[model samples]
Target: MAEARRMPSETAPAGLRERKKEETRRLLREGAARLFAERGFEGTTVADIAACANVSVRTFFRYFDSKEALLLPDGIKVFAHVEDALAGRPADEEPLDAVCNALLAAAEPFAASTLTALGHPLEDIENVVTGRLVQAFSAFEERLTVLVRRRLPADTPDADLRAAVIAGAALSTVRAVLRTRRARRASGMTETGPAPLPRAFEILREIGSAGRP
Candidate 1:
């Protein structure tokens, strides 16, 4: 009989391999962003991005489906952070406040970076990039709904509808802030910095309170 194969120990090199893979993905993402910004999205090719990152074309495919995916990393990170924040909120916190605070916490680091990624002044971003970003945020709405539902009683009437409404309002508030901030910067009315996330949450709180009996 053939000898049984020995299983790899938990202390094997898996962690190192995973770290290297993540590093490669980061390089590809950063390289693509720089190239796309310098040469316009349509003008930049997968091969060009791979060359910029010092990786093979196959490696790029292993990391992202297309160049469009590079614009999405920050958005994906934001939603993940929001999910974690909501999961950790105090049980007694009001539902809308929980959602608002969660999103505000998640957005703090990315606020300025997000605007920079889209292009400073924001108006310079290509239509294709904007469309892709909208698609990403739409997917995030579904995730937000899941988080909001967690804050409500399991058997609450109209729980899903409530969650949906809250999620929609939260996302709409963020989008409005982005547009307003960008316009302000473009018009030379304000210096670029973190988006008014606290103010957005305050507005959300007021809206929620006003809607109640």
Candidate 2:
């Protein structure tokens, strides 16, 4: 019988390799963002991103399946924030109100947060990053709609679907408003106020609450 292959020993070297992989991924993502911002997403090539990150083209592929994935950055964190918000709703809160509240809270970080406030102008990066963010968010809307449906009472008629639709619409509206605000600020409109996330949630709650009675 052939001898069994010895498994690699579990040790410090293995830990170091994992850490190195994470660092490489972070570097690649940052480099790709810089290039995409500078050259436009359609104009930038994977090889260019690799060169920026100081890694081989093959290594770029290892970190990101494709250039599109590079635009998404860390999805796990976004989803986790959403989940956490949902988990924190008050027991007395209506389902739709709870969801709206959760989404409003979860989305705050992205709306006029430091990332959008201090970074390169998003309007300039629309071709590469902003456009992709919109598409990804549209998909997220569909997923959230399904999640609403799953969480609804069995006898609930349009409430589930309506909540999901409103949730998506609300998020889309908020994003559009924020984009315009960012653009205005870039053009020297220095006194932009907070994005209308809370108002959007209020609208969603109003529509959803009507179904309760």
Candidate 3:
């Protein structure tokens, strides 16, 4: 009998392919951040970022819609994750606690790597990406309002206004902490020093309570 021909090894699993894609995207993001920092966002080109990432321009486009998207590499994912976190909170949990926890969860990645692959601090990137950051935060505020509204009693008076105020306050608290941390770092503070997230959360909780009837 003729020997049965063996088929090539099964195609790579979906999970493996996804992991590879994510890895490629991450490399491109880091590469772009470094190049943008070194050469300035306007000075850097897509081709330059692709070269730095060792990927083709096509591959870069696959991961990011445009160079500006590099400013917040995982902006959509971060906000989506925060929304999911808020949705998963215990039904009876205080609105403040839910929002604070969601924000903290979303901040984990930044806390893990406070600096870019190029060894430039995040604050430096923030300075370069302020415009993009504002746009991202505006989107964040809308989502946050929805989340806050869901946590409030349906019959509450001026629920929309209250939700907007809470969302604005919460975001402001986070931004304030970020500014303080950046200033402290600029003053030569150690990287391992106290974190500002906790303080920000504390203030958020206070704001939440104050808004309650």
Candidate 4:
């Protein structure tokens, strides 16, 4: 029998190749973060990241197009994962809880984001990238709002506004978690796993209920 094609684009079983690609991506991201932290942006070259990950500079480009690209959030994979997870959520689950849990399900890779792991303040990032982050997050809010709307009752009062607020609040909670990551890493501390996320949702629930009765 002929050797099965192992390319990621090939139709044959490529599980091992895909895993290797994923692992390579993770290593490059981690290497980029470490170097960016130690040397700042301009000082950290693509060659340096490749060297850190034990790959050729050519291989680095195959993964990330550029150093700046490495610093951006993993929005595409995250959005897709969140969408699928939300679809899998139980129909009877509360809207907020379903959304929260779905977001949490997509948290691991996101929470370990390279730029976030660097723990730099917003002001420290370039103005162009900072603007891009703002744009990216607005898009994130819109997507999350759509998911939130689906879980809400059809007869929800001021349905659009309510759903938007729920989505905004959920996105804010995620932002809080990422910000906490920056702060903790800056202070030489470590993350508290997903504990902060649920705790944030708990606080939001308290505030929401406080106005109810």
**lDDT of prediction 1:** 0.72
State the lDDT of candidate 2 residue by residue for 1-213, as single tens digits: 123333334465788899999989878878876776677666788899899888999988888878766655455666667767777877656666666677677654643342352255554453334444455455577666766665666687787667676557656765674565456656876643444667655655576568685
Please, what is the TM-score per model? 0.69, 0.64, 0.65, 0.61
Give the Cα error of residue 190 in candidate 2, in Å.
9.9
Estimate every model's Cα lDDT from 0 to 1: 0.72, 0.65, 0.71, 0.72
What TM-score number comes out for model 2? 0.64
Off by over 4 Å in 3: 1-27, 30-47, 53-68, 111-135, 190-194, 207-213
Candidate 4 lDDT over residue span 1-213, tens digit each: 244444444644577679899999999988877876678777788999999999999999898767777766656765887888889999999887887788777664443453467776333344324334434455688878877887888988987888888888877776676666556656778665557777878877787789675
lDDT of 1 by residue, 32-140 (tens): 7787668777788999999998999998988888777676555677577778888899998978888877777765445445447646423344334444544555679
Better of 2 and 3 by lDDT: 3
User: What residue pairs clash in candidate 2, if any at all?
Assistant: none
For model 3, what is the error of residue 157's alpha carbon versus the real structure, in angstroms, after optimal superposition?
1.5
User: 54, model 4: CA deviation in Å?
Assistant: 12
What candidate 1 gets wrong by more than 4 Å, as runs, is 1-4, 9-20, 30-45, 56-58, 71-76, 111-135, 191-195, 211-213
